[model samples]
Target chain A: MMTATRTKNTTTVELEGDRVVVIARTFRAPPRHVFDAWTKPELVARWWAPKSHGVTVKSIDADVEIGGRYRYVLSHGDNEFAFSGEYVEIDRPGRLVYTQVFEAFPDQPTTITVTFEEEDGLTRMVSREVYASAEARTAALESGMESGMRETMDQLDELVAELAAG
Target chain B: MVETFAALAEPNRFRIVELLRSGPRPVNTIGERLALRQPQVSKHLKVLKAAGLVEVEPRAQQRFYALRPEPLRRLDDWLDRYRQLWDERFDAMDEVLEELTQKEDEG
Candidate 1:
Protein backbone atom coordinates (compact mmCIF):
# COMPACT_ATOMS: atom_id res chain seq x y z
CA MET A 1 0.00 0.00 0.00
CA MET A 2 2.86 2.39 -0.69
CA THR A 3 2.04 5.35 -2.92
CA ALA A 4 4.30 7.97 -4.49
CA THR A 5 2.78 11.13 -5.97
CA ARG A 6 4.51 13.52 -8.34
CA THR A 7 3.51 17.16 -8.20
CA LYS A 8 5.09 18.10 -11.53
CA ASN A 9 2.54 15.90 -13.26
CA THR A 10 -0.77 14.36 -12.28
CA THR A 11 0.74 10.86 -12.04
CA THR A 12 0.60 8.62 -9.03
CA VAL A 13 2.65 5.41 -8.90
CA GLU A 14 1.46 3.03 -6.23
CA LEU A 15 2.80 -0.31 -5.04
CA GLU A 16 -0.09 -2.31 -3.79
CA GLY A 17 0.33 -5.64 -1.92
CA ASP A 18 3.99 -5.89 -3.00
CA ARG A 19 3.52 -7.13 -6.57
CA VAL A 20 1.53 -4.44 -8.43
CA VAL A 21 2.63 -1.08 -9.75
CA VAL A 22 -0.37 1.14 -10.35
CA ILE A 23 0.12 4.33 -12.37
CA ALA A 24 -2.65 6.85 -12.93
CA ARG A 25 -2.71 10.05 -15.01
CA THR A 26 -5.39 12.47 -16.05
CA PHE A 27 -5.47 13.63 -19.67
CA ARG A 28 -7.22 16.74 -20.98
CA ALA A 29 -8.56 14.74 -23.93
CA PRO A 30 -11.85 12.92 -23.95
CA PRO A 31 -12.03 9.18 -23.16
CA ARG A 32 -12.55 8.11 -26.76
CA HIS A 33 -9.51 9.96 -28.01
CA VAL A 34 -7.35 8.68 -25.21
CA PHE A 35 -8.52 5.12 -25.79
CA ASP A 36 -7.83 5.39 -29.49
CA ALA A 37 -4.33 6.66 -28.88
CA TRP A 38 -3.67 3.71 -26.63
CA THR A 39 -5.17 1.06 -28.91
CA LYS A 40 -4.04 2.26 -32.32
CA PRO A 41 -0.52 1.14 -33.22
CA GLU A 42 0.26 4.22 -35.32
CA LEU A 43 -0.83 6.57 -32.53
CA VAL A 44 0.98 4.53 -29.85
CA ALA A 45 4.24 4.62 -31.83
CA ARG A 46 4.18 8.40 -31.58
CA TRP A 47 4.31 8.54 -27.77
CA TRP A 48 5.29 5.17 -26.35
CA ALA A 49 8.91 6.12 -25.75
CA PRO A 50 10.58 9.41 -24.92
CA LYS A 51 11.57 11.17 -28.10
CA SER A 52 15.01 12.01 -26.74
CA HIS A 53 15.96 8.36 -26.60
CA GLY A 54 16.54 8.39 -30.35
CA VAL A 55 15.12 4.89 -30.51
CA THR A 56 13.21 4.06 -33.64
CA VAL A 57 10.04 2.06 -33.29
CA LYS A 58 10.74 -0.56 -35.91
CA SER A 59 7.28 -2.00 -36.05
CA ILE A 60 4.01 -2.34 -34.18
CA ASP A 61 1.61 -5.20 -34.84
CA ALA A 62 -1.50 -4.88 -32.72
CA ASP A 63 -4.81 -6.69 -32.70
CA VAL A 64 -7.03 -4.75 -30.35
CA GLU A 65 -9.48 -7.43 -29.30
CA ILE A 66 -9.81 -10.11 -26.67
CA GLY A 67 -7.36 -12.99 -27.21
CA GLY A 68 -5.53 -10.84 -29.74
CA ARG A 69 -1.77 -10.28 -29.72
CA TYR A 70 0.47 -7.23 -30.00
CA ARG A 71 4.18 -6.90 -30.60
CA TYR A 72 6.32 -3.77 -30.63
CA VAL A 73 9.95 -3.47 -31.60
CA LEU A 74 12.29 -0.58 -30.97
CA SER A 75 15.86 -0.17 -32.15
CA HIS A 76 18.57 1.90 -30.48
CA GLY A 77 22.08 2.06 -31.87
CA ASP A 78 22.04 -1.42 -33.42
CA ASN A 79 20.33 -2.90 -30.40
CA GLU A 80 16.77 -4.04 -30.71
CA PHE A 81 14.27 -4.40 -27.90
CA ALA A 82 10.95 -6.11 -28.31
CA PHE A 83 7.88 -6.52 -26.17
CA SER A 84 4.85 -8.67 -26.90
CA GLY A 85 1.50 -9.08 -25.23
CA GLU A 86 -1.87 -10.78 -25.51
CA TYR A 87 -5.09 -9.07 -24.74
CA VAL A 88 -7.19 -10.80 -22.11
CA GLU A 89 -10.06 -8.35 -21.85
CA ILE A 90 -11.19 -5.39 -23.90
CA ASP A 91 -13.93 -2.86 -23.26
CA ARG A 92 -13.63 -0.10 -25.80
CA PRO A 93 -12.91 3.38 -24.44
CA GLY A 94 -13.13 2.10 -20.89
CA ARG A 95 -10.97 -0.86 -19.91
CA LEU A 96 -8.30 -3.21 -21.25
CA VAL A 97 -6.38 -6.12 -19.76
CA TYR A 98 -3.28 -7.73 -21.19
CA THR A 99 -0.29 -9.92 -20.44
CA GLN A 100 3.04 -8.37 -21.32
CA VAL A 101 6.55 -9.85 -21.60
CA PHE A 102 9.71 -7.99 -22.44
CA GLU A 103 11.93 -10.00 -24.77
CA ALA A 104 14.92 -9.16 -22.59
CA PHE A 105 13.26 -10.87 -19.65
CA PRO A 106 10.97 -13.44 -21.16
CA ASP A 107 10.61 -15.45 -17.99
CA GLN A 108 8.99 -12.64 -16.09
CA PRO A 109 5.58 -11.91 -17.55
CA THR A 110 3.37 -9.16 -16.17
CA THR A 111 -0.34 -8.50 -16.38
CA ILE A 112 -1.48 -4.96 -17.07
CA THR A 113 -4.95 -3.48 -16.75
CA VAL A 114 -5.73 -0.04 -18.11
CA THR A 115 -8.95 1.85 -17.45
CA PHE A 116 -10.14 5.17 -18.80
CA GLU A 117 -12.80 7.27 -17.07
CA GLU A 118 -14.15 10.57 -18.29
CA GLU A 119 -15.04 13.35 -15.93
CA ASP A 120 -15.97 16.85 -17.01
CA GLY A 121 -14.52 16.16 -20.46
CA LEU A 122 -11.16 15.06 -19.04
CA THR A 123 -10.02 11.45 -19.18
CA ARG A 124 -8.37 9.77 -16.24
CA MET A 125 -6.25 6.79 -17.26
CA VAL A 126 -5.26 4.21 -14.70
CA SER A 127 -2.81 1.43 -15.51
CA ARG A 128 -1.91 -1.38 -13.14
CA GLU A 129 0.98 -3.81 -13.77
CA VAL A 130 1.05 -6.95 -11.71
CA TYR A 131 4.28 -8.89 -11.66
CA ALA A 132 4.58 -12.59 -11.00
CA SER A 133 6.06 -11.82 -7.60
CA ALA A 134 7.62 -9.06 -5.57
CA GLU A 135 11.01 -10.47 -6.49
CA ALA A 136 10.07 -10.37 -10.16
CA ARG A 137 9.17 -6.70 -9.91
CA THR A 138 12.40 -6.05 -8.07
CA ALA A 139 14.30 -7.95 -10.73
CA ALA A 140 12.75 -5.77 -13.42
CA LEU A 141 13.96 -2.70 -11.56
CA GLU A 142 17.43 -4.24 -11.28
CA SER A 143 17.64 -4.88 -15.02
CA GLY A 144 19.09 -1.40 -15.66
CA MET A 145 15.91 -0.44 -17.51
CA GLU A 146 15.39 2.43 -15.10
CA SER A 147 18.93 3.74 -15.57
CA GLY A 148 18.57 3.70 -19.34
CA MET A 149 15.30 5.59 -19.09
CA ARG A 150 16.80 8.03 -16.61
CA GLU A 151 19.68 8.76 -18.94
CA THR A 152 17.32 9.70 -21.74
CA MET A 153 15.26 11.84 -19.39
CA ASP A 154 18.38 13.58 -18.15
CA GLN A 155 19.36 14.30 -21.74
CA LEU A 156 15.92 15.77 -22.39
CA ASP A 157 16.21 17.94 -19.29
CA GLU A 158 19.61 19.24 -20.38
CA LEU A 159 18.25 20.15 -23.79
CA VAL A 160 15.33 21.98 -22.22
CA ALA A 161 17.62 23.79 -19.80
CA GLU A 162 19.91 24.86 -22.63
CA LEU A 163 16.99 26.19 -24.67
CA ALA A 164 15.59 28.05 -21.67
CA ALA A 165 18.97 29.58 -20.90
CA GLY A 166 19.49 30.65 -24.51
CA MET B 1 21.68 -4.73 -7.96
CA VAL B 2 20.09 -8.17 -8.19
CA GLU B 3 21.74 -9.14 -4.93
CA THR B 4 20.39 -6.02 -3.32
CA PHE B 5 16.83 -6.77 -4.46
CA ALA B 6 17.10 -10.42 -3.50
CA ALA B 7 18.38 -9.55 -0.06
CA LEU B 8 15.63 -7.09 0.63
CA ALA B 9 12.95 -9.35 -0.84
CA GLU B 10 12.73 -11.53 2.23
CA PRO B 11 10.22 -10.31 4.79
CA ASN B 12 12.55 -10.68 7.77
CA ARG B 13 15.43 -9.02 5.97
CA PHE B 14 13.16 -6.19 4.81
CA ARG B 15 11.98 -5.69 8.37
CA ILE B 16 15.56 -5.65 9.56
CA VAL B 17 16.38 -2.89 7.12
CA GLU B 18 13.38 -0.89 8.28
CA LEU B 19 14.50 -1.37 11.88
CA LEU B 20 18.04 -0.23 11.14
CA ARG B 21 16.77 2.93 9.41
CA SER B 22 16.20 4.71 12.76
CA GLY B 23 19.81 3.98 13.76
CA PRO B 24 22.42 1.24 14.06
CA ARG B 25 22.07 -1.69 16.43
CA PRO B 26 23.91 -4.85 17.47
CA VAL B 27 22.60 -8.29 16.53
CA ASN B 28 21.30 -9.03 20.05
CA THR B 29 19.60 -5.64 20.28
CA ILE B 30 17.92 -6.05 16.90
CA GLY B 31 16.84 -9.57 17.72
CA GLU B 32 15.39 -8.42 21.03
CA ARG B 33 13.48 -5.54 19.44
CA LEU B 34 12.12 -7.64 16.57
CA ALA B 35 11.53 -10.73 18.76
CA LEU B 36 13.87 -12.70 16.54
CA ARG B 37 16.65 -15.03 17.62
CA GLN B 38 20.29 -13.87 17.64
CA PRO B 39 21.37 -16.35 14.92
CA GLN B 40 18.39 -15.36 12.77
CA VAL B 41 19.27 -11.67 13.00
CA SER B 42 22.89 -12.42 12.21
CA LYS B 43 21.89 -14.44 9.15
CA HIS B 44 19.71 -11.60 7.85
CA LEU B 45 22.46 -9.11 8.56
CA LYS B 46 24.88 -11.20 6.52
CA VAL B 47 22.65 -10.97 3.48
CA LEU B 48 22.22 -7.21 3.94
CA LYS B 49 25.97 -6.80 4.25
CA ALA B 50 26.63 -8.77 1.07
CA ALA B 51 24.07 -6.62 -0.75
CA GLY B 52 25.93 -3.42 0.27
CA LEU B 53 22.88 -2.20 2.14
CA VAL B 54 24.52 -2.42 5.56
CA GLU B 55 27.96 -2.53 7.12
CA VAL B 56 29.19 -3.88 10.41
CA GLU B 57 31.76 -2.47 12.80
CA PRO B 58 33.21 -4.31 15.79
CA ARG B 59 32.72 -2.30 18.99
CA ALA B 60 33.69 -3.90 22.34
CA GLN B 61 33.43 -7.42 20.89
CA GLN B 62 29.92 -6.62 19.55
CA ARG B 63 29.42 -5.97 15.83
CA PHE B 64 27.04 -3.03 15.29
CA TYR B 65 25.31 -2.90 11.94
CA ALA B 66 24.25 0.36 10.26
CA LEU B 67 22.66 1.09 6.93
CA ARG B 68 25.01 2.23 4.15
CA PRO B 69 22.38 4.46 2.44
CA GLU B 70 24.11 4.12 -0.95
CA PRO B 71 21.99 1.18 -2.09
CA LEU B 72 18.80 2.94 -1.05
CA ARG B 73 19.89 6.06 -2.91
CA ARG B 74 20.50 3.97 -6.02
CA LEU B 75 17.06 2.43 -5.65
CA ASP B 76 15.43 5.86 -5.47
CA ASP B 77 17.27 7.01 -8.62
CA TRP B 78 16.14 3.87 -10.39
CA LEU B 79 12.50 4.34 -9.35
CA ASP B 80 12.45 7.94 -10.62
CA ARG B 81 12.65 6.72 -14.22
CA TYR B 82 9.25 5.10 -13.97
CA ARG B 83 7.68 8.41 -13.04
CA GLN B 84 9.65 10.29 -15.68
CA LEU B 85 8.69 7.84 -18.43
CA TRP B 86 4.98 8.28 -17.78
CA ASP B 87 5.30 12.05 -17.57
CA GLU B 88 7.01 12.30 -20.94
CA ARG B 89 4.61 9.89 -22.64
CA PHE B 90 1.60 11.75 -21.30
CA ASP B 91 3.03 15.04 -22.54
CA ALA B 92 3.31 13.57 -26.02
CA MET B 93 -0.20 12.16 -25.75
CA ASP B 94 -1.43 15.64 -24.91
CA GLU B 95 0.01 16.87 -28.18
CA VAL B 96 -1.64 14.07 -30.12
CA LEU B 97 -4.99 14.80 -28.54
CA GLU B 98 -4.62 18.51 -29.30
CA GLU B 99 -3.99 17.67 -32.95
CA LEU B 100 -7.07 15.49 -33.00
CA THR B 101 -9.13 18.30 -31.50
CA GLN B 102 -7.94 20.75 -34.15
CA LYS B 103 -8.74 18.31 -36.92
CA GLU B 104 -12.26 17.86 -35.59
CA ASP B 105 -12.73 21.62 -35.37
CA GLU B 106 -11.62 22.04 -38.99
CA GLY B 107 -13.99 19.33 -40.14
Candidate 2:
Protein backbone atom coordinates (compact mmCIF):
# COMPACT_ATOMS: atom_id res chain seq x y z
CA MET A 1 0.00 0.00 0.00
CA MET A 2 1.52 3.27 -1.16
CA THR A 3 1.27 6.02 1.43
CA ALA A 4 1.62 8.81 -1.07
CA THR A 5 -0.86 9.04 -3.93
CA ARG A 6 -0.53 11.33 -6.96
CA THR A 7 -3.44 13.30 -8.40
CA LYS A 8 -5.64 12.35 -11.33
CA ASN A 9 -4.17 12.43 -14.84
CA THR A 10 -0.80 12.97 -13.23
CA THR A 11 1.48 10.89 -15.45
CA THR A 12 3.92 8.59 -13.73
CA VAL A 13 6.90 10.82 -14.32
CA GLU A 14 9.83 8.70 -13.22
CA LEU A 15 13.28 7.50 -14.22
CA GLU A 16 13.46 4.76 -16.82
CA GLY A 17 17.05 3.56 -17.03
CA ASP A 18 18.41 7.10 -16.68
CA ARG A 19 15.65 8.68 -18.79
CA VAL A 20 12.30 10.23 -17.91
CA VAL A 21 8.87 9.40 -19.34
CA VAL A 22 5.89 11.73 -19.60
CA ILE A 23 2.55 10.32 -20.70
CA ALA A 24 -0.62 12.23 -21.58
CA ARG A 25 -3.96 11.64 -23.28
CA THR A 26 -6.39 13.82 -25.21
CA PHE A 27 -9.72 13.24 -26.93
CA ARG A 28 -10.68 14.72 -30.31
CA ALA A 29 -13.01 14.30 -33.28
CA PRO A 30 -11.24 11.63 -35.29
CA PRO A 31 -7.87 9.94 -35.64
CA ARG A 32 -7.27 11.27 -39.13
CA HIS A 33 -8.22 14.78 -38.13
CA VAL A 34 -6.04 14.65 -35.01
CA PHE A 35 -3.16 13.17 -36.99
CA ASP A 36 -3.52 15.87 -39.60
CA ALA A 37 -3.64 18.54 -36.91
CA TRP A 38 -0.25 17.25 -35.67
CA THR A 39 1.37 16.62 -39.07
CA LYS A 40 0.36 19.82 -40.81
CA PRO A 41 2.46 22.87 -40.05
CA GLU A 42 -0.36 25.37 -40.53
CA LEU A 43 -2.60 23.54 -38.08
CA VAL A 44 0.35 22.88 -35.80
CA ALA A 45 0.81 26.63 -35.51
CA ARG A 46 -2.65 26.84 -34.01
CA TRP A 47 -1.74 24.48 -31.13
CA TRP A 48 1.64 22.74 -31.52
CA ALA A 49 2.86 24.17 -28.17
CA PRO A 50 1.97 26.29 -25.14
CA LYS A 51 2.17 29.89 -24.05
CA SER A 52 4.99 30.59 -21.63
CA HIS A 53 5.08 34.39 -21.27
CA GLY A 54 3.57 34.09 -24.77
CA VAL A 55 5.31 31.83 -27.32
CA THR A 56 5.02 32.85 -30.96
CA VAL A 57 6.31 30.49 -33.61
CA LYS A 58 9.04 31.86 -35.87
CA SER A 59 8.83 29.00 -38.35
CA ILE A 60 7.32 25.52 -38.77
CA ASP A 61 8.36 22.77 -41.20
CA ALA A 62 6.97 19.25 -41.06
CA ASP A 63 7.20 16.27 -43.41
CA VAL A 64 4.71 13.52 -42.62
CA GLU A 65 6.68 10.63 -44.10
CA ILE A 66 8.84 8.28 -42.09
CA GLY A 67 12.46 9.48 -41.79
CA GLY A 68 11.12 12.96 -42.50
CA ARG A 69 12.14 15.96 -40.42
CA TYR A 70 10.15 18.62 -38.57
CA ARG A 71 11.28 21.81 -36.88
CA TYR A 72 9.81 24.87 -35.21
CA VAL A 73 11.11 27.92 -33.41
CA LEU A 74 9.21 29.59 -30.56
CA SER A 75 10.11 33.05 -29.39
CA HIS A 76 9.15 35.52 -26.70
CA GLY A 77 10.43 38.83 -28.04
CA ASP A 78 14.23 38.51 -27.86
CA ASN A 79 14.18 35.11 -26.13
CA GLU A 80 14.24 32.17 -28.56
CA PHE A 81 13.29 28.49 -28.29
CA ALA A 82 13.68 25.92 -31.08
CA PHE A 83 12.69 22.24 -31.42
CA SER A 84 13.61 19.93 -34.33
CA GLY A 85 13.46 16.22 -34.93
CA GLU A 86 12.65 13.38 -37.34
CA TYR A 87 9.91 10.79 -37.74
CA VAL A 88 11.03 7.22 -37.07
CA GLU A 89 7.68 5.61 -37.88
CA ILE A 90 4.40 6.77 -39.37
CA ASP A 91 1.34 4.51 -39.33
CA ARG A 92 -1.14 6.43 -41.31
CA PRO A 93 -4.05 7.99 -39.32
CA GLY A 94 -3.14 5.88 -36.30
CA ARG A 95 0.36 6.11 -34.82
CA LEU A 96 3.54 8.21 -35.10
CA VAL A 97 7.01 8.07 -33.54
CA TYR A 98 9.30 11.10 -33.72
CA THR A 99 12.38 12.58 -32.12
CA GLN A 100 12.55 16.14 -30.74
CA VAL A 101 15.38 18.51 -29.78
CA PHE A 102 15.53 22.00 -28.38
CA GLU A 103 18.12 23.76 -30.52
CA ALA A 104 18.35 26.85 -28.28
CA PHE A 105 19.18 24.55 -25.35
CA PRO A 106 21.35 21.65 -26.38
CA ASP A 107 20.33 18.27 -24.92
CA GLN A 108 19.63 14.72 -26.04
CA PRO A 109 16.62 14.38 -28.34
CA THR A 110 13.38 12.97 -26.88
CA THR A 111 11.56 10.18 -28.66
CA ILE A 112 7.81 10.82 -28.80
CA THR A 113 5.24 8.24 -29.77
CA VAL A 114 1.59 9.21 -30.38
CA THR A 115 -1.21 6.70 -30.83
CA PHE A 116 -4.71 7.47 -32.06
CA GLU A 117 -7.71 5.27 -31.42
CA GLU A 118 -11.26 5.87 -32.63
CA GLU A 119 -14.32 5.14 -30.48
CA ASP A 120 -17.81 6.22 -31.42
CA GLY A 121 -16.24 8.60 -33.91
CA LEU A 122 -14.20 10.36 -31.22
CA THR A 123 -10.46 9.90 -31.29
CA ARG A 124 -8.43 9.20 -28.20
CA MET A 125 -4.89 10.43 -28.58
CA VAL A 126 -2.14 9.28 -26.26
CA SER A 127 1.43 10.56 -26.29
CA ARG A 128 4.45 9.13 -24.53
CA GLU A 129 7.48 11.42 -24.35
CA VAL A 130 10.82 9.92 -23.28
CA TYR A 131 13.62 12.25 -22.27
CA ALA A 132 17.35 11.51 -22.02
CA SER A 133 17.79 12.06 -18.29
CA ALA A 134 15.74 12.38 -15.13
CA GLU A 135 17.14 15.87 -14.77
CA ALA A 136 15.97 16.76 -18.26
CA ARG A 137 12.54 15.33 -17.47
CA THR A 138 12.28 17.35 -14.28
CA ALA A 139 13.41 20.43 -16.19
CA ALA A 140 10.76 19.86 -18.84
CA LEU A 141 8.08 19.39 -16.19
CA GLU A 142 9.13 22.57 -14.45
CA SER A 143 9.06 24.39 -17.80
CA GLY A 144 5.23 24.23 -17.95
CA MET A 145 5.07 20.97 -19.93
CA GLU A 146 1.80 19.96 -18.25
CA SER A 147 0.14 23.27 -18.98
CA GLY A 148 1.51 23.28 -22.51
CA MET A 149 0.10 19.83 -23.24
CA ARG A 150 -3.29 20.77 -21.82
CA GLU A 151 -3.48 23.92 -23.95
CA THR A 152 -2.40 21.99 -27.02
CA MET A 153 -5.17 19.50 -26.37
CA ASP A 154 -7.68 22.29 -26.05
CA GLN A 155 -6.45 23.67 -29.32
CA LEU A 156 -6.78 20.23 -30.85
CA ASP A 157 -10.40 20.18 -29.72
CA GLU A 158 -11.06 23.47 -31.49
CA LEU A 159 -9.31 22.31 -34.61
CA VAL A 160 -11.30 19.10 -34.58
CA ALA A 161 -14.57 20.99 -34.31
CA GLU A 162 -13.53 23.31 -37.16
CA LEU A 163 -12.57 20.38 -39.37
CA ALA A 164 -15.78 18.56 -38.56
CA ALA A 165 -17.87 21.62 -39.26
CA GLY A 166 -16.11 22.31 -42.55
CA MET B 1 -2.82 8.27 -9.58
CA VAL B 2 -6.20 6.85 -10.56
CA GLU B 3 -6.68 5.52 -7.08
CA THR B 4 -6.01 8.93 -5.59
CA PHE B 5 -8.63 10.61 -7.75
CA ALA B 6 -11.05 7.69 -7.83
CA ALA B 7 -11.32 7.94 -4.08
CA LEU B 8 -12.54 11.51 -4.12
CA ALA B 9 -14.18 11.43 -7.54
CA GLU B 10 -17.33 9.73 -6.28
CA PRO B 11 -20.36 11.96 -5.65
CA ASN B 12 -20.73 10.54 -2.14
CA ARG B 13 -17.15 11.40 -1.29
CA PHE B 14 -17.74 14.88 -2.66
CA ARG B 15 -20.80 15.21 -0.44
CA ILE B 16 -18.88 13.97 2.56
CA VAL B 17 -16.16 16.55 2.00
CA GLU B 18 -18.73 19.29 1.46
CA LEU B 19 -20.40 18.36 4.72
CA LEU B 20 -17.06 18.34 6.54
CA ARG B 21 -16.22 21.74 5.14
CA SER B 22 -18.38 23.14 7.94
CA GLY B 23 -16.68 20.95 10.57
CA PRO B 24 -15.78 17.37 11.49
CA ARG B 25 -18.64 14.86 11.70
CA PRO B 26 -18.91 11.35 13.08
CA VAL B 27 -18.64 8.48 10.56
CA ASN B 28 -22.12 7.28 11.49
CA THR B 29 -23.62 10.73 10.88
CA ILE B 30 -21.90 10.94 7.49
CA GLY B 31 -23.22 7.48 6.61
CA GLU B 32 -26.74 8.53 7.60
CA ARG B 33 -26.62 11.72 5.52
CA LEU B 34 -25.19 9.85 2.55
CA ALA B 35 -27.63 6.97 3.07
CA LEU B 36 -24.64 4.65 2.86
CA ARG B 37 -23.74 1.65 4.99
CA GLN B 38 -21.06 2.09 7.64
CA PRO B 39 -18.74 -0.27 5.76
CA GLN B 40 -19.17 1.71 2.55
CA VAL B 41 -18.52 5.00 4.32
CA SER B 42 -15.44 3.49 5.90
CA LYS B 43 -14.16 2.43 2.46
CA HIS B 44 -14.51 5.95 1.08
CA LEU B 45 -12.86 7.34 4.22
CA LYS B 46 -9.91 5.00 3.69
CA VAL B 47 -9.46 6.29 0.13
CA LEU B 48 -9.69 9.91 1.23
CA LYS B 49 -7.11 9.15 3.91
CA ALA B 50 -4.71 7.63 1.41
CA ALA B 51 -5.07 10.68 -0.81
CA GLY B 52 -4.19 12.83 2.19
CA LEU B 53 -7.29 14.89 1.57
CA VAL B 54 -8.91 14.09 4.92
CA GLU B 55 -8.01 13.12 8.51
CA VAL B 56 -9.83 11.48 11.38
CA GLU B 57 -9.71 12.68 14.97
CA PRO B 58 -11.20 11.01 18.02
CA ARG B 59 -13.79 13.13 19.82
CA ALA B 60 -14.72 11.03 22.86
CA GLN B 61 -14.97 7.37 21.64
CA GLN B 62 -16.24 8.07 18.09
CA ARG B 63 -13.95 9.11 15.21
CA PHE B 64 -14.66 12.31 13.28
CA TYR B 65 -13.39 13.01 9.78
CA ALA B 66 -12.34 16.53 8.84
CA LEU B 67 -11.43 18.24 5.57
CA ARG B 68 -7.71 18.95 5.02
CA PRO B 69 -8.23 21.19 1.89
CA GLU B 70 -4.49 21.11 1.05
CA PRO B 71 -4.69 18.41 -1.62
CA LEU B 72 -7.63 20.08 -3.34
CA ARG B 73 -5.81 23.40 -3.14
CA ARG B 74 -2.76 21.88 -4.85
CA LEU B 75 -5.01 20.49 -7.58
CA ASP B 76 -6.47 23.94 -8.18
CA ASP B 77 -3.01 25.47 -8.34
CA TRP B 78 -1.86 22.89 -10.89
CA LEU B 79 -4.97 23.53 -13.02
CA ASP B 80 -4.57 27.32 -12.86
CA ARG B 81 -1.52 27.25 -15.13
CA TYR B 82 -3.38 25.29 -17.81
CA ARG B 83 -6.49 27.42 -17.44
CA GLN B 84 -4.50 30.53 -18.33
CA LEU B 85 -3.17 28.88 -21.48
CA TRP B 86 -6.66 27.89 -22.64
CA ASP B 87 -8.00 31.38 -21.99
CA GLU B 88 -5.25 33.01 -24.07
CA ARG B 89 -5.54 30.50 -26.92
CA PHE B 90 -9.29 30.98 -27.05
CA ASP B 91 -8.82 34.72 -27.25
CA ALA B 92 -6.47 34.32 -30.20
CA MET B 93 -8.87 31.95 -31.88
CA ASP B 94 -11.65 34.46 -31.47
CA GLU B 95 -9.58 37.06 -33.30
CA VAL B 96 -8.75 34.69 -36.14
CA LEU B 97 -12.34 33.56 -36.47
CA GLU B 98 -13.55 37.13 -36.53
CA GLU B 99 -11.12 37.99 -39.27
CA LEU B 100 -12.19 34.99 -41.33
CA THR B 101 -15.84 35.90 -40.95
CA GLN B 102 -15.11 39.49 -41.92
CA LYS B 103 -13.31 38.31 -45.04
CA GLU B 104 -16.30 36.17 -46.02
CA ASP B 105 -18.65 39.12 -45.54
CA GLU B 106 -16.41 41.37 -47.65
CA GLY B 107 -16.24 38.78 -50.41
Which candidate should be chosen as best, given TM-score against the real structure?
A: 1
Candidate 2 scores an iRMS of: 9.6
RMSD each, Å? 8.0, 12.9
Per-residue error for A20 in candidate 2, Å, reads: 4.1
Per-model C-alpha lDDT, please? 0.74, 0.60
Alpha-carbon shift of residue A33 in model 2 (angstroms)? 0.4
A1-166 in candidate 1: lDDT tens per residue?
2156534447666555567677899987788888888879998888776565565677888999899999877765666667788999999889988888776566767888999999888898999888877776765544334445355644433322111100
Clashes of each: 0, 0
For each candidate, give its TM-score against the true structure: 0.72, 0.51
Give interface RMSD, every candidate, in order.
2.9, 9.6
Question: Which pairs clash in the backbone of model 1?
Answer: none
lDDT of candidate 1?
0.74
lDDT of 2 by residue, A42-94 (tens): 86677544444455667788887888988776655565456788899999789
Model 1's CAPRI class is acceptable
